[model samples]
Target: MKRIARVILLLLLVAGLWLALKPTLGNRRLTFLPQHWSEYLDYMDFWLNLGAFAILGLTVWFALGALEKVLQRLCLMIGSITLMNLFLEAMQSSIPGRAMDRADIWAGLLGCILGIATGLAFQLFAVRKKSRTTSPQVLFLDQTGRLGGAELMLLDIAAARAADSEVALFQDGEFRTALENAHVKTHVFKLGEEASAVDKQAGVASALASIPAILDLVLQIARAARAFDVVYANTAKSLIIGGPAARLAGRRLIFHLHDIIADGHFSSLNQKALIFCANYCARKVIANSEATKAAFIASGGRADLCVVVPNGFQIPEERTSTAKTSALRSSLGIQPAAWTVLMAGRLSHWKGQHVLLEALKSVPTAHAILLGDALFTDEDRLYAQRLHTQAEEPELKGRIHFAGFQSDTMPYFDMADAVVHASVFPEPFGRVIVEGMLAGKPVIASRAGGAAEIIQHEQTGLLVDPGNADELAAALLRLQTDTAFSSTLARQARQAAQDTYALDAVQEKIESVIRHIAGSNKSQLLSPAIPLPKPPPCAA
Candidate 1:
């Protein structure tokens, strides 16, 4: 479709050039379409030129297709087209009987605007068509193909509903392949690198630029969403586009919020937009933790729109034997007597790998194994390098192990004396904390946000002030020396995991939310969600 649009745009540009630069037959100045009411009105020629320019605008706008990567390509395409039109007008001055006209420029610009509006109206109309498929109860939307925490969770959700659901992703990666491996019907609709690159730091201009691509993807998803009873967005980006698509398709929208919508994590513009979409569009907002829910409420998000749902985790009935865990410990070459601290997560600044390295300096007897790697970007890779430099220091030499990213973290977890989550920021939901507990190890997580919600100080696990290496060091020492206490904490933590974050209960709760809203009528056009709009007065 985009290829064909580009061809039409090229031909329109050629026709525009001919109209502006073609010599007049009489060799006198040609003013076929008079702009003023005073001059003899050439209504026929006037309408003809206006129609031509309007078609030009439509083709240009369509050629730009979703204006992906507004920062670079969007600016380039628009600037190039503007320069082309201006150059053609300039060339008309060189013609024997023609001259560049400012009135023409103004008319062309207006035509372009009208063309873009028409294209948008068409897309909006396309969404109003109701879905006919009713067998698939849900449609899951995710923006990235990478297996982040959210993708991992979605894998479980989609897999459970593989018989009656489909996953639509914006990019292609292991996440898609994994879904296919799990027998979950998956489709990839590439949203281009330009659109995906617009991150939380992106300003209003960048977002405005990405709208073309956002809308394009939304239209595609909305069309597909018509077949399903519900639309589920697993990431913030997905929610931004999916929310509108679901509403347009007359389907119930559910936003599975994985990030805490805050200035610290997202730009102010993003925070407002997310809260707006959730409040006005979605039937339910499934927050991973109460901390996530609190942050949502604090950020102008409606309090009643959110429902806290912890990511479900379950311990295996047949646990790895002690011998296997000991073997993993021996492979790392640290002495068996050395206290081991295990932290598993992507190696990023906020994930606190650096702080954990600093804390190790205060606990001389401890050895640390850092699992997970910088999954994306050069910044994280540099962070990993700095960590290596920290490990090479005399006091920390031969103690810190960089295990990198592991497909399976169970053996590493089994070998650990304690699992530490040292994120500098408040985590939305500490997957590592529950993971450690499921592995039957004591957990010490930063005491804020969702991590704080998971651990009771000195009970199931310990919590320290975020980013404080000294406090973290103290917690490590306490866990290392107090074997009996650590064992108790691990046992209590395991119980806590089984009761609250058990996989069965977590999936069941989420499925229940889906079941409740899946029956909503899909024939009706878009309408404002509850709490955002007051209910109509009841008939007595």
Candidate 2:
């Protein structure tokens, strides 16, 4: 109901903004006179307008108990007004017979500023006049210092300042800067300057090394847990370490799963370890996608504890430049005649870069640009070296190029006619495929994981059988040869991407889940662990 109200309010705001600014927009630029401003101002109008919204906003705020919950109350107020202003900006774009004016946008900005100021003014006045308390906060954990997907989501959460949220990460990673930029308080776990002796050890040695430090870290986190309403574990290591501590502290723990384990990308032991940790420690598990949630349940996880939350994205401006694409191709040493097939991700076997190579052998692409660098485990570094060697093999030489890791893959995506995600194993979520779609490029992905759920073969994008070189090759060939069919697919893919992965839609779903959990009294809301119903042993 609250979510619906919020959406309705935003829609009204958009409508109001459209009404107010309709006189200001067109293909032609125009200026307005400020001298007549006083003529338009009426004393009664000021009182009536301010009073109307103030009353409405306060009613909502008070009903939502914002008076008692400081941060959340502030979030509600800010989010409401921010959406209002954003809608107003959007309204500045002409709507048929509607009038559009830049002045109205300026007015909307003024209104937002006044609203926020009014809110702060009221808060300050109330505090000065009386005493008030704030609710406990939720600590959002992100151990990965880099501003990757986990960090990006954490940044958005921080920006929302939703439900007394705060962020914590490793001391050295780039996430601290991102959090700081978002005006989110940053707390470092400070697990020393480097991974402890135990963290550096692999297999048994590494497991032993991580145990004590992790346990100690858990205790420390448990102590700090007093300040938070809940401790959210955003990374695998944190889930393993922080879950027990949160439980010990009698606090709720949320373990967010961003990756799928049984995807054979991780070693057998690594997969088992992740499941074991999740099963034993997490009070609740938040899977980034329904596919991940299903995978977890299949591996003896508690279904009741699992919550499906798909990934979100902010659509980037479409960049068009034939010259830029040509430049990118030139820099990569590709001939204009060669068709450049692209695959992007952190270079890893689990990511299925090798699958792309195996498929490449069956296809007749002019060249392929493999983008990304070794990340997380070094298990795939040697595999990458071997892939390079394979690329140099008699038939494949000069046909495959290692482009290394690129922060901005837009140029690469633009250079390629189609983007491929040939993951032999299921991906927890295939962000690249969506990104490719958003870039208005057709995609071919493995029929597993999130890709299976998002792509409709021949409609939005192509899906090939996982680990099947022949199918992937055929899909690639069809895309390369059939421009009309490919364009249709790209168009549909873009629409689907916009509809499903757009920031606002994705954020709405995420916020709804967070609001639901925050409203609950239990620190941990475990999903029921139900056994998977058997399918009659494959009818053998």
Candidate 3:
């Protein structure tokens, strides 16, 4: 019915625009009105303009995409619709019987306001009319629909709880398609420029200035969250909106801390803001790594609120298919006997794609397949271009496969002999490292932060110093040179990953935390923390 109404309104808009632009009909008949209807009013044209444009504005509103329903977009549409009508009104100057009238312009403006109000009221009423019993049990909030480490982890968690939870993304991208592909319910509640302008590096003034946009998003999320038992924020940006929304909705909030909230990762002001929100709003903070948890506490976040939980990576069993692996290798131009190393992460300076390229300089004949794309910022895009240039250089030419972003990296993983984690800085929790382990490939991870905590030195996987190309190169050389040791490392890492980071086990641990927090009613100060499962004992 709504679709039919929208179509009729659109057709009415086109007809009305056509009639308004056409020359005035000379007394044959413009209306089927009791021909005496205009006898009662002197401003019949003004009323016609009002009614026509009101319907026109409503039509425009309904025509907008769901993500474009924010105030910024609405205002743009309203302004455009008004200007179009005014232009038609001005074109009246060219007609003999019609002249531009200020009254007609005023009527159009009034009609647009009415239409905007009606549309917004109808949307709000729809939400308010929904019963709490019918709402999703869990409302998961995420900052972006770009598949970063945090987002990938969130996808796994949300997919596991698809029957009871729904994810709300701040922006739209491939993440939505991933969710749909995984059979998980998802929605996009887009944030406009103001919300985006205030990033992790934003100062206090920038944050203060974005309050209006923040508050608006909060209200919307709060209204929708009233039915959910828990409001789970999947990223730092999500916390900015989810914290206040959860408070308003009177629901327990879970902050899944994916970042190391320290000097390099965030501005001092943003660090303070994150601490303030987590302390005040979150019932429980689920930190991805001990480094992340420690950083949160060091930056003034409450220690009692945080609990460390590793990211549960859902590895497809089919990634182990040797036939598919060989096909991928053939497609990517890896020689049958070439030693290929796989590095997967977004293209950013801190992620050290440059370091990997430099390391490849030392390991001359080794081929590297770089997965992931520049998902955010102009800087990253620039870096990506530079990488392409670097890849073309003499020592590295054709040896590096710049295989941009791959939705399912499993095939790429299957094609590689070893997986590398090359972040220049401390990773909060190395999702790719665990993924490498699960894929049954030898991994050489940066020896800092969660990567240090996950690998049991040379027993399970090799660890290299962060940003050291020589160390990375040497590890690459050793993995290629000593095939038996590499196979042993891969076997042990796979066993450890299977025992500790299995989907069902990790999901149940997190669900326990969620249930404990949600059922507490603020009675208990903290829920029992889920300890990292013991790594399987390794061979000598």
Better of 1 and 2 by TM-score: 1
Q: Per-residue CA lDDT of candidate 3, range 1-540, in tens?
A: 458767887788778776776665443224444546634443477887787678777766666612212556667877887898789878978976677888989999888777766765666455445423333378999988788888888888888788889889888999999998889888888788777767778877888888888888899999999767789999888998999998777677999999998887888777777888888888899998999998888887888889988888665656557788787888988887899999999988888889989999999989999899998777789999999999999999989998888876778887899999988889999988888999889999999888898999998899999999999999999999999999999999999998888877888889888777755633321222322233222111
State in Å the error of residue 32, model 2: 82
Better of 2 and 3 by lDDT: 3
**Against the hidden reference, what TM-scores do the models get?**
0.72, 0.67, 0.71
Model 3: lDDT to the true structure = 0.82
Residue-by-residue lDDT tens digits, candidate 1, 244-353? 99877867888999998776788888877788788877888999999999888888777777898899875687777888878888888877777899999998888999
The runs of at least 3 residues in candidate 3 whose Cα sits more than 4 Å from the true structure, single-residue gaps closed, are: 1-136, 522-540
| RMSD to the hidden true structure, all candidates | 13.6, 21.6, 15.4
Against the reference, the lDDT scores of all candidates come to 0.81, 0.68, 0.82
lDDT of 1 at 100: 79
Question: How high a TM-score does candidate 2 get?
Answer: 0.67
**Can you write out model 2's per-residue Cα lDDT over 205-264, one digit (the tens) per residue?**
567556666777778888887566568888776776677776666556778888775635
Clashing pairs in 1: 66-212, 66-213, 131-226
Clashes of each: 3, 14, 0
What ranges in model 1 sit over 4 Å off? Answer: 1-136, 522-540
